[model samples]
Target chain A: MRLVTTNLTFAEVQPKLREVVDTLFKTVPAGVGSKGFLKISVPQFKQVMEEGVKWAVDNGYGWEDDLKNTEGYGKIEWADASKVSDKAITRGINQLGTLGSGNHYLEVQVAHAANIFDEKYAKACGITTPEQVVIMVHCGSRGFGHQVGTDYLKIFEDAMRRYGISVPDRELSCAPFSSREGQDYYKAMACAANMAFTNRQVIMHRIREAFSKVFQRSAEELEMNLVYDVAHNIAKVEKYKIDGSWKEVVVHRKGSTRAFGPGNHELSSRYQEIGQPVIIGGSMETGSYLLVGTKKAEEETFGSTAHGSGRTMSRAQAKREVRGEQLQKAMESKGIYVKAVSMPGLAEEAGLAYKDIDEVIDTLDRAGISKKVVALKPVGNVKG
Target chain B: MKQKYKFFDDIATADAAFEAYGKDLPELFTNAALATFSVMADLKKVAPKAKKKIVLKNPKAEGLLFDFIQELIYLKDAEYMLFSKFTVKVADGKLTATAFGEHINPEKHQLLTDVKAMTLHMYSVQQTKSGWKAFIILDT
Candidate 1:
């Protein structure tokens, strides 16, 4: 029931998290290049880049406090409107609230504890039913992000060569936090990060409407509430236990999620006992999970864990190798209803193309990075 | 001969450069649009009955060729047609191309991910001693 800005940091909802996660994803927009419920003008879009979820809420999309529970309270500290190019703006103008495609999506799931920890968290999050529905939304900044990344890559790459930085991979090109190039990238990235947060917020509002339309009930009656939200893709300058003095380190979480442990002020006061909630989205066919950050996370991975089941094949390769109709038939057999803008997209995101999420969870758990809280099974899904 | 990159241009829904480079930059940038139209239908069968003189602005010489090919892909996707051949000149992000193509079928073709769009992902244009090279990542 809370807006994500202030209180819900991943800590308090550990118990009922699986149900929360399953229920949440069903509403949020996700999938590679999934479009949003609405569009905004470039000016308004710029506001989104600047204000994050608050901008959407101010525009009548969400609650004022929703930003409180959100990471960075939706607005990134380093966002720079100037850093975004006109082409990026052009690409993003019509796509402000879109989900985009690929692993991004909105899915409905159910959580029942097969394990004690899962059960405990489910109870705490008020997810009492083993068959309770949950939603999961997996997405980033969409085309805006792509453009930002692309736009910045050239700048940073040129800067890298200018500054004489040699990295193993072109994709890994980055500048130091103190450098001018680094500063520019950070500012631009913040803009994208804020847009991503706002994008999810707008998508969540649309989800509420979709639910109300389908179920014929008010959102409040359905008890659709945001459990927690965290972003792991961007890098941040934060206080970490570096040399035990909480030195500032630039933590880059690519394809990862921040798993801040219990007792941090970032979490809602109520959730301080459990820790920040960690959301892990799996492929559409397999399922997802809701977990709590561990104190040990600070030591292992800078309080981060895997983002989703990483892609096993490129989309082009997927299209070249797989068929859409056959892929849809397989999903239907498993009782997961599917709808999409493109059949080829369904084939591209075929469940077989990813690593087993169950195994991924096992590795995370065994690795002691993020502990498992609850497991979700899919019911309905839509992808682009 | 056929590059694996999905797309090179951002908004490719109309008339655009369709580079299909194979062994050389000139050829690769020239044929991308042709390859794109082929995806819509049979390029060999299309009589090139409809011809249009077209040009586009590519931001970079190498990426511009990539963008040209993506433009052809966009046209095919939106028009359900194909363009067989093109001649292009790329400099300082601007591309001028003369393209000839025709309408065709889709069901007979194998459609890949309806590319939502393309953005510079691993987009690079390099010239080797033997030929030209480029890599593109399309958001499917």
Candidate 2:
């Protein structure tokens, strides 16, 4: 997930919400078979796999500061393009600068003054004024990641038989982290991670262009600074104090994300005083939250927190309960303007399908995993 | 009577799940392709404007099914194509097929979710009383 704060307020963008959404929907391709604007060759795409957002910035896709705001500077240093398969490269080469379908979205939100929980953290993170307009993008490495996973899962399943390892479920296939197969998968997965960062960075560039076109101002003049970008369901090596000694282990956070607290050396200089920003995206109808990591999380939860409001209902059930067109009309009546490519797709993501986000965040907060900084209510959305 | 395919409501919550049925191996493979593509687009709206051929060999019928669906998804992502109609033949562990569809046009096709990959969770191919049945869970 990634968030960007603009100088414009919600009141300023509300009247032009439809136009803004339309502009974004046109600029950012969504839904099945959505292709990107940039067309790079397979070799050039390999450079992207290794270099991540650096390649984007160097190629004029984004600004230098975008690197700073991104997690791991928007690139995984250990990523190896050679470890990535030809099929994975083929799947990802054309998918940059696009928003994919199914629960992925780009939303325009407002940070109401009453919703601001900690003014100090909010101000530090560029939420200085009431009704501050922000953009949140929820997507990931696209088909490239999926292919990498498919390739490795097959390899690991085969490796398990050779290594005399057994699991009850085939989906839980694994190879020891120290094994060659495991290391190859790790490096290949890093390449996919880089691909995702570059993907979002390229999309961010498109978003900046869209906002500039709609508002009639340069992105810099609009102060479209990216607050932060983070990933979920990723595993990385971290040092944790276990028993009497500090041990380095590969922490696989499925359906969770890193919530490193303040003063942690892992944090970039910009976020050293404050903790890592944890973006918790809720359903499009309900609001989302901006929270900072806590020291307690590092001690108790392996520096991790929840990824999002867990789904309470399945997609088919949601579609059975809600009609997309009716849901759209209802949201418009409730002041949330939305543009969707497919109605059935829209119904599948109805807010009723998700759990109460406030309750989820409250649980995290009470446990000191993260602290609330700001609450953002949706005003406009481009649903994928 | 055997239906071509049907989507399941509770099998996989976050992704898509479906079951495809056929009287034999070839029909089963063809119906599986149909079921997989149906998740990404409306078959009726996707005109068969072009054709492509596929030939794959896997010792296991289940592996062949997985590869067949994976190939379709790969084409969707790599070539920007969606196939609504398929003609498949599976013989002696070798599978060959032809798929027909057009390049996806946002204006022409009622495109839905992109089926990213096939998953191993609850994925199976079995023979029932009347026909061959296969269960698939696609990661969207």
Candidate 3:
């Protein structure tokens, strides 16, 4: 997930909601089999797997400061392009800068002054003004990441047999971390991770350009700064005090985010005092939250917190309960304009389909895992 | 009652789960392909403007079913095509399929979820007293 705050406010953007969303929808491809504007080849895409957002910045798609605000500087050092499969490359090569479907989206939100829970942290993260309009995007490595997982699941299933391992379920198929297959999977996963970082960076570039066009101001003049970029599902090797001694272990964060507290060396210097930023994306109809990591989280939960206000209803049930047209009309009545590729897809992402965002954020804040900084309510969205 | 497939309401929360039925392997494979693509596009509206031949082999019937559906997904991403019609033949551990579809034009097709990968979670292919059945959970 990523959030980019701008100098513009809700009042300034309210009238141009449809035009802004349409411009964004056109700039960034969404929906099934969405292809990007970049026409790079397999070999060029290999460089993307290795370099991450650095490739985007070097290719004139992003600002240099974006590197410092992004997790891992937008690249995974262990990424090895050779470890990635040809099929994975083929799927991901044409998928850069896409928002993708099934709950993934790019929303224009307003950070209400009253919603600021921690004024210090909110200001520190570049969210200062009342009703500040910001862009929040929820996406990931796309098909490339899925294909890597799929390839390894098949490989690990066979490797488990060779290793004489038994698991309760097929999804638990595994190989020792030191094994060749495990190392291969990790390297391949890193490649996908890098590609994902680049994917968001490319999308960010298009977002800046679109805002510039719609608002008739340069992205820099508009102060369209990326607040932070984080990965929801990723595994990283980190050091922790285990049994009184610091040890390095692989921490897998599935459906979770890394909430590294203040003073952690991993965080960028700009956030050294505040802590790592955490973006919890709720359903499009509701809103999302900006948070800062807590020391308690680092000590108790391995610096981890919930990724989002998870679904309360399944897609099939959501579609049955709500009509897409009705939901769209209802949202418009409430001042949230939305553009979707498919109606049924829109119905599946109804706000009622998800748990309450306030309750979820309150739970996290009360647990001392992450401190709420600001609450951003959506004004417009481009759904994939 | 006879049906090609039915989506489950509770099996998978973040993904789509379904069961495809057929009287035999060929029909089962074809129905599975249709079920998979239906998650991506409105099959009735996706015109068959192009065609592709797929050949795959796996010793396990379950693995064969996995590969067959996976191939269609592969094409969806690699070729930007959505297949609505399919024909399949399985013999001597080899499966051959002919799929028909067209380039994804948003104006013509109502594109839905982007089915990324097929998961082995609750995945099964079996022969029943009445027909062949397979349960699949697709990652979106």
Candidate 4:
């Protein structure tokens, strides 16, 4: 999720943002050989899966106030670590704070006051001026989540056969929602979701440390607080009206984000009067946006919106079209500094490979699903 | 004749899928593992500096292939190793293989995107009139 705070203004940190970009690229572990900054044993990894961000905050990585702004207060209630497989635990043990490769990045962006559409709502989320700089960290449960999915696909395949359920494709293999296999997958998924929440929380701590070093001030002095955090690519049981009758159903959001409207009980207290913060990440060469959910979204799209600018080109095509070094120089010419592990990796995520984010956001705005609050232009980026 | 193995651009826009073929089951499994790693890094540049043995058992042939490729992905993420050479043997629903590769040196090796996982979407392993063929999609 992307985060904003009442921190240093753009002018005050422009030069440092450059330095911080390099520092973050080097400081934060990325790619295959990069291990996490903090080491955790299997037991500690289990605790992370169980407690999520609360575990990080309890360990002094972040403050309690940080939780107040996070989704679900940074922990999902249904997470059961016992359901997580040992293979998943082993994959997550050393990857606690590291950002994985391919589209995962830490970016520093500036939100101009003039660009903000809703002054009251934007201010409530801590965006006050054009000079205020924000940080956006995009990542997920990493190998842990992948392993869980792999382990369950095999289980579900067998369960599907046993239940005598057949689908058009093998990929669609699934058991009844009330069955034991279904419940077990849901519990294991919650653990992975919690692991992802903990991942973002720990990365925020690293960002604060990087800022403190560059500005010669503590994180508190900088007022670096989390604006909001959201989860994508997960399933949840949500109550919604169907045929004029309220019913409970599992809302599966893949490549999407939950955009609960004002007064939705799921929102944190600070955002309850407004709406859930919906983060739409753009390519590193392009800029991202901050949005607030609308009642229309709840009525229409099950309180969900697009997660990112949809890809328009394949990675192979992107590599064939542009060189990473040339793309980096172009970004630098536009004042967006980049640090990446490999040039080929960078080429795979070129801006030309994606749709115009401004157009995508405009569709959501014109459609009344989510309203744009502020536009964030990138200043520094650390990519894996 | 079609090549032993090659990648096809997925219509889903971001991922890549591959088809592997062999005259026998073990050869088909070996080719599939090679195709999976090729998606992550250039296989030609990887050196056989180290080797590890992997053993897996599954009641079904497709399950064994899925688990085998997943095991390689796990090693890539957890141990930071990339295997370029594989020798696989399958007998009675059991798979044993010796994989050789070195630790990922970012400076020396120009790594591509990390292959996150093997997907069941369009996953298949079957026998054809010519030989054994398998198709698998990777989540990048």
Candidate 5:
């Protein structure tokens, strides 16, 4: 998500945004063999799994207040480091503060005044003008999360037979929620969730550094505070009304965001009166959005909302439809500076490959799942 | 002979899916490994300059094959290597394979995307009229 600042116009920072994108692109490439900004030992990696965003801030990667703005205060409780496998720890050891490939990006955007729906909410988020600049960092737990999922799939598959459970598809392998295998997987997943939070926190720190270097101003001067961060892919145990009775259930929101309404205790006090901030990331060429959870969302849909514009075409088809160079030029023509490691990778994420973000958000708004707070137009992007 | 492996774009809604064919289980698994790497980088450019030995065991053939491909993905992220050639041997629900590739050279190998892990969604390994076949999906 982007940091809100005053009087930062697209024209003034266009050059700087381009430079930042170029630097980030060169610094973080896609796929294997790419180097990360931070290097940590095995012990430090364990700390990341245990502490999440708090670990990043303690390591001087971010401010302490940044945790307050993050979901779950930047750390999920019950994340047992012992649950994480040695392979997962090894994969995460060196990949901290790095942005991985395929649709993961860091973009510089402006909140257009005309698109601001709720002035008070926008101001509360520190955005007071159309010229206000924010940097959206999109990444996750990297290979650490991947390894955790891979490890659990095998474990769950094996446990299914022991528990006399069978599914039509192997992907649906499972164990009883209260079973040992289930609890262990949950703990391991929480570790990955923390890894993702820390991953974004570290990347935000790097973004701040890049801005500081380019503008010759401190992050504090820029008011580069995190507005809010939400985890889209994960499961959480929460109490929700089911059949007129409150029931404790696990909500698995894959490609969705938790949009708890106003007065929800889980939200930070600053945003408790309004709602949890939800960041919706779009393609490199298309713009993004900032929304707030609603009471209706709580009553319906399990307080969930769409995470992004969503893909309309397959990657292979996207690559076949548009050449990367052509897509890059098209994005440039639209005044969006793009820095990428591979042309094919760039082409695979062409804006046309996704649904219109405005339409998707409109649907959410109409459904009362979430209400739009501000619209952010991308000016610069670094793709992996 | 029919092609050893080929990718199907729509087989998965959000992943890369492929079908590997072989006259035997070993050849089927070998082609599956090749298909997996091909999704990560251009296999032709991945030189056979480095060799890594992978051993995996499972009570089921499908599970063994899944683990075999997952090991390759692990090596890609852990060792930063990309393999284009493989000599796989499967016996008694165990896999022993010698994977040949080199360290990822960004200049030489144009990476398409990172293959994070193999997904069991619609995963299958079966004997066919021709020989054996495996269907696999990779989470990117």
Candidate 6:
């Protein structure tokens, strides 16, 4: 990815695009106890890190050669098994392909549609469907990531007092990349990241299988391509030009995305022409977007963009605001079919609970971190 | 004792409850857990037709609380069941409990947006002068 040259000039991101408006809702997982596919063991779970999409491919989940375009071939750098904690192992054992509840989603989105501004860019990123059934999975390392973060947050806080690293917030705590603790944390984090990539890949495979059964088409005929996969809660050690010099900085982007534009060395050489495809998932009711990283994004937001419409209300609040049954009726009126355990989850996740997604994307566009290529309006969703 | 839930002006947090009754931590936790569920579906219509025991490992105070909510949500999502009475105990800080719930009558359970995941953001638990208070972020 040599993005020293980005051809995205008239390429300002459209932020919140709405062309398909319905078909996107037809895909993905939602809600509590969302299916994790088959029961997997802790040992095979370790294989998840070692193989990434390879495990998925081996299990008839995805393509082994898909690694060519994946970031680090979908495996995080040096994900040693020893780094993951026992509790993380317990949580990961059963949650291999499960889409964790709340905000994390498996959505059916129409990635790109119409001439909506950047047609050339959309075509380059393989957004072929004027109304395409693109399956998008939003998940992470599950309990593994949460436990690693929780376990290490304690370590970092204790070390902070030892090292005297001044920080404004305790949550922003960090140890240098060179230290023993930092290295362990990095390894553990990498394991989680790889697990997440593997998790999504597995879910993608399950989705393809389900779609195959539903549409009566082979996986190849369905063309469930892996457009791009990015981690939201992640940190990367990448070279960013700061103060007119390439600085190897550890970029910590929590609740933000990596919006890398054209000619970046980190990207696969094949994608250099269009820029990195960035996935921004909106609420079930709101829909999602596909944006490309901009050079301006590198300059601003630490090469980041907002992860999703930041929640403005709690599930509790949404529950209070709308009854689950009535909300379902409302969504049905809008032509979106939702299946959930309770109305509270539906109301809480109601598109209105968060900041206006289009506004958030517009903010990112104005900030110049990323620009929209395709807008997907969800028509169907599966709540766990 | 009745404790009211008030939403602190939070961006990611939607519902919150703070209640304290008696000095019993278990009772306090029971109240907090019930408070969160009450916001979703009415427990009045729910009957204790079946009882199930659950165990979660490495359960610190916070992890136990998190797993507790997740377990209930899982039962609801997977089994179409919702619990009313939670007889929970934190022995040596590990979770051991018997919960009472029944299949969610499709006609009764209010279906909200399924909570996708619980977030570490703005999560906290503390013993208040009255009893206990906890804040959690539910990914929607």
Candidate 6 global CA lDDT score: 0.64
Q: For model 6 chain B, where is the 10-residue window of minimal lDDT?
A: B14-23
DockQ of every predicted complex: 0.16, 0.79, 0.80, 0.68, 0.71, 0.31
Q: Which candidate is the best by lDDT?
A: 3
How far in Å is the alpha carbon of B73 misplaced in model 1? 10
What's the TM-score of each model vs. the native? 0.78, 0.98, 0.99, 0.97, 0.97, 0.78
Model 2: how many Å of interface RMSD?
1.1
Off by over 4 Å in 2: none
Task: Give me the runs in candidate 4 sitting further than 4 Å from their true place.
Answer: none
Model 4 per-residue lDDT tens digits across residues A99-152: 888888888988877678888878888887666899998998889899999888
Q: How well is candidate 2 docked (DockQ)?
A: 0.79
> What tens-digit string does per-residue lDDT give for candidate 1 at B1-140?
45622443323321111223356555667654544443333456666667656577656676566456555544443343456666666556677777676654333333223333444445567776656655544444
Query: What docking class should model 6 receive?
Result: acceptable
True contacts kept of each: 0.08, 0.78, 0.75, 0.65, 0.61, 0.39
How good is model 3 by TM-score? Answer: 0.99
Per-residue lDDT of model 3, residues A207-267, tens digit only: 9999999999999999999999999999888888888989888899989999999999988
Kindly list the per-residue Cα lDDT of model 1 for residues A1-384, writing each as its tens digit. 111111111233344343443443454444322234575677888888888888888888877656666776788877889888876776666566566654567776666446335666555555565456666676667666666776666677678887889887566767767898788888888988888887777777876766655556666666666766678588888777766577788888887888877887777764677777778887788888777778888776788888777667655456667777777777768867676545776776777777798899888888888888887777567675
lDDT of each: 0.64, 0.90, 0.92, 0.86, 0.85, 0.64
> Candidate 4 has what TM-score?
0.97
Which predicted model would earn the best TM-score?
A: 3
Candidate 1 Cα deviation (angstroms), residue A39: 3.9
Chain B TM-score per candidate, please: 0.61, 0.96, 0.97, 0.94, 0.95, 0.77
Interface RMSD after interface superposition, each candidate: 9.3, 1.1, 1.0, 1.5, 1.3, 5.5
RMSD of each: 7.3, 1.2, 1.0, 1.6, 1.5, 6.6
Give the clash count for each candidate: 66, 0, 0, 2, 1, 52
| Candidate 5 residue-wise lDDT, A283-377, digit = tens | 77888999999999989988899899988888899999999989988999988888777788889889888999999999999999999999888
